[model samples]
Target: MKVKNIVRTVAAVAAGAMLIPLAACGGGTAADSGKTKITFLSWDNEQTMSPFIEEFEKENPDISIDFSYAPPTAEYIQTLQTRLVGNQAPDVFIITSENKNDLIDNGYVLDMTGKSYTEKLSQANKDFVSRDGKVYGQSISSWAAGIAYNKELLKQVGYDTVPSTWDEFLDLCKKLQDNGVSPYIEAIGDGADRIPDSFTGAILADKGIDVTTLASKDPQTPGANEKEAVKAWMKVYDEGYASRDNVGVSGDDAKTQFVNGQVAMYCTGAWDFSTFEQAGFDWGFAQIPALDKNHEQYAQGSPSPGLAIYSKLDGDKLKAAEKFLDFMVSDWSLEQRSKNGDAITVDGFESDVTEQYKDVYENNLKTGKYFLMTNFYSNPDVLISTNNAEVQQLVQGSITADQWAENIDAKMASAQ
Candidate 1:
């Protein structure tokens, strides 16, 4: 995972490409070096993936790995897409809601059904791995999305506990606002951001709807349940709870504001630990408040980062790729992940999460309430992108609740 090692590997690969014709004349395949090397392309930079890679290499001396990382989700997606199309894809890659379909549809990823690695996952973990009954990825962990609040802010508002009902939440927000604090701060510029934490929860609570199903539909003809979910989201706008100014706020901006004590609560995922730790405040986490008293306590999330093998790999290289992936889901890998604050998904591997966020992981464990965000589960990327823009506009007061919902519907339709 060292940057230098990565640079060397990439350089070697580039050089190999240039030498392909020469090597062809010399009558040696790239695999002729007598070692099985599986190239892994990760969205996580080299530093984060280094320890795990080291562990895998130490355990399997017969197989060597070369890793290349692209920046995060966006750049990684573009890079992998190009690589796959060019037949220069890495032997193993990270798969997520964003690029799973493209990989599966184009046959870039291997079908992992009945593989030994697939059997190691629990049934719940299996759900995200399969598409139309064909498995393509191994979901490593699960996460929860909700509110992270400053305990001091709640105390100032005369509350010892985070509100569980929308009504009380609004009242709390109003109190915080009166006290010269931004009651709630969220990244609303992208439809896929805030909705997953707030309105998406409301939608799940309202009708027991599965966001994935609705998102999978023709965007133009979003089901009645999906529309209702959008309506519930608008309630935040109607009540002046979430701000329209958030349209200008990036995720980093919102996190900074929350950490600096400018905001009382932030709606985001469990992954914001680094941000919260830097904030000089006493904080607590909780599930998204339920909609009314009848709604279940639901939050949005997805399987954490996971591994996929490229379909192009065959024979010994394919076997080595599969071995590395299996190593990733082993008990040791889970323990490493737990120690690193990863939420647990594989059965029998519990999280050793930090004390501050223990409640967050505990709630996810207890309720089994973790659900992937709508955009992650949906198709045509445009739906998620458009919805993100429209939601940001809605938060900024540039658009009405009806307009926001209409925009969502329009995007969904156009995608179809």
Candidate 2:
């Protein structure tokens, strides 16, 4: 899911909550025209969701969707939470890794078990949003976070492609640095942990640990096996492959640096093609590097956010909600979403992804390593805030790599 999209149209790593007076939030009755009105709260800006909503309404005249108001993740969580506790939540809303636990544990989301639309859903999507083996959220699409390389810049260092292993990667970075080129940069100011996190998950996965299980657990927990992952990540900075000053850069700045040829590599996802393609230089993507020659690359991901219903919805309103979700995964909706740049989830959903991304997708096909590591952590703040802060410290040499790992382990333990 997008933590990748914050730089683009905002990709979805399926990830959100507050209390208010009943009517103040969304306490509307059915429409007088005999249409069942369902309120939808989304993390997507209204402009992004408008066309999809319009199309859904056009198809199902019996249901009307009300997007009273919705903001991005940080704020939407607070606003939606107040409404949920006040019994005024929108009828249809999003369930992400951050909010999945509270929503499912408190019975806020409807149980979607055995729904026909879910039959062909990917196990990755199902596992991300489910609790106790029952599905709750309808994850529609996905994207991956990886390294984007400047093909021309790397060519100056005599490399045709990004290296597959970390030790080799350091050599490449050194060659570029010696050539007066900054080897890599990522917007660490805004949750830039995805690159390191994805690579770490790959290392752990090759060790036979399913990172999804450890996602909600602290990495430094006794026997957790996350230490090696953190050590490898710290090496990229510790060994001078990337800059410590990157702590001040934002995602946009990283993109701009790459465009200006100020940097030879960038850590981000596929969403930035619109900007990158405009660059004067030739570029391509690389699977995230692994720990050594033995490990396979892994990228962080989750099913894109899908339609979810409030548990209390019933009768015609319930039917409408289910129908809307059904329609979302229908061939038409999947095709439309895929056309608009989403890497959709439904099996056999053909995507309009470009030749460049075809390589990225194919790299992970055999391993199915779309790692949803941080999202599996129940407290959204851990990935959104804490992990970033700790990673910054690791980069700036304020904390040892082990200390950073310990910080996250403690955070996860506290979350539990």
Q: Against the unseen true structure, what C-alpha lDDT does each candidate score?
A: 0.66, 0.71
Write one digit per residue (lDDT tens) for candidate 2, span 1-416.
35532211222232121222222222244343778777777767666667777788888877777765555564555566767887777788888766677787788999898897676677667767776678888886777766788898999989998888878888999999999988988787766756555666666666676434554444435213455666777777877878888888898999999988889999888878778887757888887777677766777665676567999999998888888788878887778777777776667765767776776665552235666555565665554566677877877889986787677777767756
Query: TM-score of predicted model 2?
Result: 0.85
Q: Tell me the TM-score of each prediction against the true structure.
A: 0.80, 0.85
Candidate topping TM-score = 2
Candidate 1 is scored at a TM of 0.80
What residue runs in model 1 are displaced by over 4 Å at the alpha carbon? Answer: 1-33, 120-125, 175-182, 189-216, 219-226, 312-314, 365-368, 372-380
The residue pairs found clashing in candidate 1 are: 190-388, 191-388, 219-412, 219-413, 220-412, 220-413, 244-395, 244-396, 301-371, 301-372
lDDT of 1 by residue, 58-159 (tens): 798677777776755555676677677677887888887677767777888899988888776654356565666667888766776678888888899798
In model 2, state the lDDT of residue 224. 35
Q: Given candidate 2, what's the lDDT at residue 284? A: 86
Deviation from native of the Cα of residue 71 in model 2, angstroms: 0.5
Please report the candidate that would top lDDT against the real structure: 2
